[model samples]
Target: MSGDLLATDIEAYLDAHEQKDLLRFITCGSVDDGKSTLIGRLLYESKLIFDDQLAALEADSKVSGTQGGDLDLALLVDGLAAEREQGITIDVAYRFFTTDRRKFIVADTPGHEQYTRNMVTGASTADVAVILVDARKGLLTQTRRHSYLVSLLGIKTVVLAVNKMDAVGYDQSVAAAIDADYRQFASGIGLDDVTVIPISALRGDNIIETGPNLSWYDGPTLLEYLETVEPVGAATGGPMRMPVQWVTRPDPSFRGFAGQLVAGSVAPGDAVRVLPGGQTSLVERIVTADGDLDVAVAGQSVTLTLADEIDVSRGDVLAAAAEPPAVADQFETSLVWMSDQPMLPGRPYLLKIGTRTVGVSIAQPKYKINVNTMEHTAARTLELNEIGVCNLNLDRAVPFDPYEVNRDMGGFIIIDRLTDVTLAAGMIHFALRRADNVHWQSVEVHKEARAAQAHQKPCVVWFTGLSGSGKSTIANLLEKRLFADGRRTYLLDGDNVRHGLNKDLGFTEADRVENIRRVAEVSKLMVDAGLIVLVSFISPFRAERRMARALLEEGEFVEVYVDTPLEVAESRDPKGLYRKARRGELVNFTGIDSPYEPPEDPEIRVDTTTMTPDEAADRVLRVLRERAILPSAGG
Candidate 1:
């Protein structure tokens, strides 16, 4: 294969088809994973670069690379100066190439675990991903993370390219072992039809030609695989996905909406429905920049004129007439946190899903998956690189499908509202509806009527304390007092309430906040029932307590700070949680593994070390009376 295909018909072919049939593939690997070298090798061996391009690469290579002469593939895509200095891929560099069969666009992304977000950007539109694992070393933690994210971003095909096989003596057993491990992880994540091939990108073994060193291996060479690899599937199922890019008026006489079809297909005169506002229209024409077309398939960018202009705008999708996406204001999502800063729940951010961008809040952290063990642990908050499930509350919901089923509409990005930095990338699970069974029990009266019935007035007594600060004891006593007084009352104790009511929840900062929010809502309902509610849990963050207060009517929720000195709480160690926390036996444990942010101006403060449980209960009762949420115990 002479590197002179540019002189042949290949050049003209690429120029013609790249306008419509460009399929992009990106290579991702950690620093020293040979991403740039692999690409440079591909381009060089493929005869894609001209003499001048090769000369420039050689000249630039002398000044940039670590060894000081060979044009490192890393230099080709590491366009940033910081990246060159640090010797890593930082930005998503778009590279172009062409094979005999297809025009190609490649986005070589970064590999450092911290730079995982770059992978999201590159792979967002990728049809195929080539993930590199060092042949001698096998799969690392970052390997699994990258693979998981590749699946998350909806890349349909994955090539587990085991590079540097020569380093391991072209050992079949080593390659087979790594391949087996990757297959297990990929299968566990439900990644479809993965291919693993062993190759030495440096020595050109099994890359473009058959290597004599590996007679034991019988597989298609990398170039042969690329030639035959079909990027898109034979079928794309259901509902046309046309993300409106712009509304164009070439002439006032004719107006059309333009965008690319992410999936499905559209034909002239086909019935289409526009969302998030449902309005039906007929497709008058499928217009391309060059001319009008009768039909367009998935991935073809085209414009269409509606037979009648009822209403349409950018950010709205023109879906198929039947089986339009479900409109939702809330959704369940699986999020992979990529930012260094921890995700702030209850805070607003811009959610960019498809062409639509809406404001959203992190409402619930369902569970955190322990990647190493593949165990689902309860989550309260997601830290850097943590993956979890959460309920995303959008200011205005859009129609969506579960990520497992639809990649175009299911994947989304959360950008920090303040910084505009991309925070996390996620997949949608389902929409949340108010129509779901209300856990709030039957009431013969309305909320106002229920409030009137519990003459003492209903309110939530939210307890804030260290792990062993006697919160549950005081709450139990307070509940007994309210129940004895014949006042409608309920105690939402931590361990007890969690058993059935919140058995599904786990202990992460996001989950902890979610746990409190659910508890607060239940407390709010009980309060509306005109009950005196005692919520005895260590509601840590001040932000969460303030939110609880905001949910209640004026003076209806009481925030109590149970200030037991850390030393004293540690000494009492009733649950041995502190000892475990100290020895690092716990993960993300507050007051030890994590910093516990204490409250400043809580409504009531009780020094549990000095006050008896009865005294603490009395102190809480006093606040309830102060708010008129309770009468004297005898009343």
Candidate 2:
């Protein structure tokens, strides 16, 4: 064709595409379930591939094709070199295509167990999930997992495409059996809107056109179903919520809050509330790049100008005043663990919800859901690809709705602070009762008044070291020295406290984290009472120690690292923990089986190889006196 003719054709296509409704869907299932092939066939049959691209695909298929002497339709979607070589999708590959009736955005997600995170990422924004099940293999574990994730992500529509029907000899009984089994399992998990269809993606059966072999099966093809399905929108009728993405100030006279409306609708003269800080204002105008909008519904990007000046900023939510979201610092949530590192309770993470980011910690899990068996098993932590129901405590309260009610307001991602990697995706179930019910009781005698009476500064001397490294001995002597010097002091030794306070805890990483958290809280209370608190524990993890440090005031919480060689500590092992660990009798024993992350920059370091316990105590006391935590010698 001539350039002018091609340009005219492209313009016509763009105009028609602009007018078509769009559907975003995902194809996911177990490995070898033909998800890629089904997508490739859909794109090919729709005539969306250009001639040159088709030629390249044909050539590549001949060189590295899974099927011999035939065009590999799966090559259209599986663009990665590793995917083409291994004949499986390794990452979520997105493609766009259009029919005369509707436009489509399909995410071909990986089917392997290790790429469950990739599947979750794709399903998070999808309105529908097309889970391809192998006809010969039926529904596998990954199919169940992906379906459960789809349900968790609030996707209401599901199409179970039973692929590879040719391998099963186009047997209607096999397809029916698999469909019945999947529907039964899906129904139990509250996935009620599921449509099952049989297809052979390799043979182009029941994809874009009805196959003659499946004459007994009377249903729309996959493409037809996709084009005809109702477009799911955000909960626009419930409440208006737009997280402020930017504070737009293009000129001296104009200022507006810009963001996509995730829920409800906003118009000029609508009453709105700025959340986390309950400031009310009226919407003065809705500005957009296309000029001004009289009204904007959910999913529209617009800048909103408030009638009255308010302290609205990025990370703040603008909501309908009549039906504002809840504000709470604690919530019960379900999280999908995505990282290689297991979720550790009491460890700090950066929790990002909407545009807001805050410090958060995941508490011990209530239970872990087994996707295949649907069993709720007791679990303390979530490993990679595991899903668990847990409680989360945030650094501050923010406005949010339950994920089931409003996805954008309730969904969040946890990021590792040090690595900056996304660790998990979470959906808020509900705010905890304590978040609303708990209130701080005011007291007249504060720490300052008590410190004046005690004639010393309040602080916590945290002593952390390996087992048999003399942490308790040094702390015990240090407390005695402080007491002898006319200063009020209290000693919280690990073993003594474990016998009473932390008796239910074990030696696992999670249990150890909780144990240290309790000790830190108690130490905080003691310091508030204007007593110098000496904490002696083999707190191995730096993250937990940092958590403890964060709970106290600036000058308080002095970290005293007791440095001892592993061989020396093992030789002096009074508890025989090292011996037991060596014999495989004890698991999660720090310095033997478990890891010990020593503090990189402690305030005080005591090497027991050279210094005696009394000398260590004197060094601590000298430092305390030098810092004015206690009075100098004679004074």
Worst 10 residues of 2 by lDDT: 1-10
TM-score of each: 0.68, 0.94
Q: Write the per-residue lDDT of candidate 2 for residues 1-635, one digit (tens) a residue.
A: 32344467988766666888778899999999998888889889887799999999889888988888478888998899998788889999999987778888999999998899999999898989999999989988999989998999999789999999999889999999998999999998888889998999999988877778888899998888998987454336767999999999999889899999998899999999999899999999999988999999888899999999889999999999998999999999999999998998988899999999999999999999988788999998999999999999999998999999888999999999878899999999999988557789999999999998898989999999999999999998988777777889999999999999999999878889899989999999999999999999999988889999999999898999999999999999898989999999999988988988899999999999999999999999889888889865444
**TM-score computed on alpha carbons, candidate 1:** 0.68
Kindly report which residue stretches of model 2 are placed more than 4 angstroms away from their true locations once superposed: 1-9, 231-236, 632-635
lDDT of 1 by residue, 8-124 (tens): 778765565555455678898656777877787787777778888778777778888764686665566677888878887777888887666666788888888777777778887
lDDT, residue 81, model 1:
86
Evaluated against the true structure, the overall lDDT of model 2 is 0.90
- Candidate 1 worst ten-residue window by lDDT: 1-10
